[model samples]
Target: MTDTLTDRPRGRQVDPAEFAYADELAFLAAYDEGPRPPGWQLTPRAVVTFIAGSGGTAVELPTKARRKGLPSRLVIGQKFVGDRAVVERCVVTLAGERGLLLVGEPGTAKSMLSELLSAAVCGTSRLVVQGTAGTTEDQLRYGWNYALLLAHGPSPEALVPSPILAAMRNGAVARVEEITRCLPEVQDALVSILSDRSIAVPELSGTTDATVHAVPGFALIATANLRDRGVSEMSAALKRRFNFETVGPIPDLAAEIALVRRQATSALARSSSTFAVDDAVLEVLVTAFRDLRAGRSVEGWDVDRPSTVMSTAEAVAVAVSLGLAATYFPGDRDVLSLVPGHLLGVVRKDDPADGAKLLGYWDGAVRRRAEDGARLWRQLWELRDALTD
Candidate 1:
């Protein structure tokens, strides 16, 4: 029950899930007076509600807890848009103190889901080890403080704890981001940390500090992009330790469009500006993105899928860009006209040859839609030069 908000921060460009949803967390904690795993701040059900939202319902707080200064009723806002069952499974895994691995394509919000779960379960998501090729065992375990080590000589005081080590001690969640990006050996450092729930310090043998035992609620959450499958294939032993969940792209086109609108508007609001991109313009933008990503148009026309991942996250970025252009330039050109160039940019990221694919898409799908007399598609069809090299 660490009040992570004890020291509220100010002027952060992007607030972590813990800080952003501090109120909702507090409400859920008090609202659910059920039994929770030791060291957890909220129950399993509360954690799900905190992530997926309360289905637009306002939960009423118990009178006993209400006197403690919580709201009588509050509507839980949905943070991550996905299956509630997926979130529920993640919560159950963490409740059992098992390592949870969120596997998904790039920009699928795997990291965001990890952060929210960690924040709700342990009251803080600050303990994290960003896995990369350069990440060393010392970063996941413990390293010696050079200055202290020189004076103390293998003493506990000289042992600098890594974020994972700190989490083990505090019984909080330790997040490993892009775990597959780390070398196989570096990644294997976690096997013992998860299985044995302890790290052995050979140098500090014959002392209590020699072995660090994980506290009651310690667990790990690792996120791997599906695209990084070969970068560092997780060892069978390591993979056995985690419950895997695959997060895919938004399934519904309308849901995807609404998500793009919401995220883009929030991003623009950070700068004290409105999302000036029109809804129809957003629809067109999202429609094109969906068609390109799926390799099939809404009307069943075949499209040449680009090598680049046309993720929902990228769509939000493009929407934000459109909003920014409209707000800053003030009608320098139709925002709709900028769609082709922006799409070309997204589709060209992985393969330069994807430019030809985009041009082919315009020649085929854009032409057909324009021929069918859709004004937006006709305008887009006229701007085919934007996709040319």
Candidate 2:
């Protein structure tokens, strides 16, 4: 098994399931005698509980005792808001030793999902390669330290192991973020790493074997943005080496609202600002987001969409501002007044075209809501002048 700790800490080493969601993961892992890949500490069921969270749903935990409180660090929450089946497929793919590529637009939480999965699967998300323009083949393979290579002449000491190499040696999951941002050649370097499941280091002669095969339970999870489509598309051969999973924007309104509310609190807490947005304001804001994002009003009226992507993340920002306003400026004034202003901040992206879309939303959704006897919404409609400027 991989050492779950580094040298610096000398204390009790609790398993991830026990520490993460003690009640949930413990129960799942206890009853979950499912087939586990080699070197994997938890069964696949335990891994799911770690990512999606136990959700207060009852599951039997292991009878083992080591520390106080729940088994795991419940602080790090289950972040992704999507289908559980998608996450299941991802876990299954990794267990099969296949590369899992998460493709999505910006602000879709692809990176976060990848991190959570890595953390749950192997108890650590540190093994990673941030793909960028300057990323090199050696980043995904192995590089040699010039000084050590010059002195010791290509030995293990001189060998600078990349994240992939470290993961291979330790059977940990490795993540490649913004993979399409890397140059085509650099991206192509993963082909051999995914297929052969090993890398050859010809430079480190006589140190060890030229090849380094992956230890059991080792896998690769890479994330790429669809916006990078024109940049450097993954080759057909490389595409074939991995299971492609696309993460779209959050689909459910209530779920999106809950997520926005949670993130808004965090943002306010970060700046020591109190959130002031009322439930009415949040509903309006999220409704606006869903309509604009889908390019149609809730009543099925066609509305022009801005070029800017209206994602759940942006809604959270709007909600945070509203919350801060409520906390700081307590008054009889309804918090719904800030909806138009925040909507401007979210929808008025890209260029003049986005401004036009905002105007269309004001003329359509806002106007229609006012006619439907929504007093709070009518007040917001009256405040539409704030968005125009």
Candidate with maximal TM-score: 1
Question: Which residues of candidate 1, in runs, are more than 4 Å off?
Answer: 1-10
On the 0 to 100 scale, the lDDT of residue 279 in model 2 is 68
Worst 10 residues of 2 by lDDT: 9-18
Report lDDT (Cα) of residue 275, candidate 2: 62
Q: Which stretch of 10 consecutive residues in model 1 shows the poorest summed lDDT?
A: 1-10
| RMSD (CA, Å), each prediction | 3.9, 5.7
Scored by lDDT, the top model is: 1
In candidate 2, which residue ranges exceed 4 Å CA deviation? 1-34, 62-78, 270-276, 328-335
lDDT of 1 at 375: 92
**Please, what are the lDDT tens digits per residue for candidate 1 over residues 1-389?**
24467865446668888898898999999999999998999999999999998888998998877856578999998888888889999999999999999999898889999999999999999899888899998999999999988887999889999999999999999999999999999999999999999999998999988999999999999999998999999999999999999888888878788889999998998888899988888999988888998999999999999999898899999999999998899969999998988898999899988999999999999999999999998999999977774
